[model samples]
Target: FMMKGVTPGPLLFQEQMPLIWILFGTFLIANVLLLPTVGLLTARIAGTALRLPFNLLLPIIAAACVTGAYAINNNPLDVGIMVLMGVVALMLRRGGFPLAQVVLGMVLGPILEQHFMVSAIKSNWDPLSFFERPIALILMGACVATVILGIIAHKRRLTGGDESS
Candidate 1:
């Protein structure tokens, strides 16, 4: 990104290092500094001056959510869908499923679909050709290896393997 002159922002600009490295180093330093600050802040907040009334926060949050929805499609249906999804997410959580899986699927859905469609089109709809391609085969092999490793790790846990070890 630095070679392409596309840095994240001014906070990561350094005279000597590439912007990418500078951004990463800045993040690391910021996180290190944040730990002590967060501890002290939490202690102080718990002591006093932490009572933010929900009346103001709730309206601000709602306005931001509505603005985001409008930005997506300029339609009320988008907002309705967002609210529906939120309700479904809450219900799923109540049923003991974490929102992480759903969120991960939402994030990766477009990329996975794009790749699959491109592979299909390039192969003229011949699914077997995807496996015949070197890169596709390597990806499939990695996927299989990951699943196998996960199964082995899960079985080990079931057999009383120490989690920390």
Candidate 2:
């Protein structure tokens, strides 16, 4: 997850895997304990917002998004990219495309490419070497299983719709 290949910590504990795991465990515990309260608060706020007219809410949401994008790097190009992406997302939404899939691809694409490139270089460009490791084979199997499940679900949904009609 550390894309830069640098783990930030004190020099004394920099290589302490146990200490790192303990910190992660503490974070997990804290988030788990806080989940219910956070969920309730979010639901309450969302319920209130649900009553607002879309016309009234849209501008505020857009402004907040623009402000957030600008605040990230104080760069106009980032704002432009945000606006462009927003337009694309709106079009995709209207076209009945699942935005979550698009977002997931956008986020995972670079990471996957990076790992693929690194693996290829390490393996002297022998693509089959990627599947030589147990972990890699397991992951590949999971990916195949996921795709099969998705195809089966899609077929069932299509047939179910036909039957219902």
Maximum-lDDT candidate: 2
Give the worst 10-residue stretch by lDDT in candidate 2.
Answer: 4-13
Clash pairs, candidate 2, are none
Q: Which portions of model 1 miss their true places by more than 4 Å?
A: 1-55, 162-165
Measured on C-alpha atoms, candidate 1 has an lDDT of 0.84
Q: Which parts of model 2 have CA positions greater than 4 angstroms off?
A: 1-51, 152-165
lDDT per residue as tens, model 2, 73-150 = 999899999989989999999999999999999999999999989989999999899888899899999999999999
lDDT of 1 by residue, 51-116 (tens): 667787677777999889878989999999889998999899999998999899999999999998
List the global CA lDDT of all models: 0.84, 0.88
Which pairs clash inside model 1? none
| lDDT accuracy of residue 22 in candidate 2 | 81
Error of 2 at 94 (Å): 1.9
Per-residue lDDT, model 2, residue 73, is 97
